[model samples]
Target: MSHRIVSKFGYYSLAGFAGSALVQLAVIWPQTWIAVVALGAIALLYFAFLLICIKGVLKGARWAGVLNFNVLGVDAIESTGIVLFFVVGGVWTCLQIL
Candidate 1:
């Protein structure tokens, strides 16, 4: 039951992220068509995996929940790394100036 809930949330979040990205790309239009194309390709691949997981969940595959947890875990790690990088960088700069 929890797996189904998480899977549904993942689907909606991924869709929302992709939609917002497209809107942003449209706003920038001509300047970054190359980037838009690259991101679009990557987004398609990401969506494919999510769809596969969705299918697995619907079919009662145990691995689907594991895959979803792994994906979300990696995302959490990546975000934390980014935040730490900036925080440490700023602190290092301040210490150097002192």
Candidate 2:
């Protein structure tokens, strides 16, 4: 695959993960100030890292591609796990609320 495509995917994945984390925070703890701040911080850091990765990819750095690929793979796995955990937790919460 072209570096551009890889870079786009990496950027999108990071954004998606940040969005999901924010959503999860809202769902699991709607009124917690600390959760809000922490999730916002995490999202910011992820965006910064994604920008750096994209720049490196555009610059034709071999190590950047390797690092980006590994980070993307790990992010994919982590997101999948987070989604599953939330799905199960949501069901449990609904049952309790009912």
lDDT of 2 by residue, 1-64 (tens): 7998778556555655554555565666877546645655665566577667768877878779
Model 2, which residues run further than 4 Å from truth?
Answer: 1-31, 68-98
Candidate 2's error at 60, in angstroms? Answer: 1.4
lDDT of 1 by residue, 70-94 (tens): 4346574454334344334433433
Per-model root-mean-square deviation over C-alphas: 15.1, 11.1
Query: Each model's C-alpha lDDT?
Result: 0.53, 0.58
Which has the greatest TM-score? Answer: 2
Residue 46, model 1: lDDT of 58
Clashing pairs in 1: none
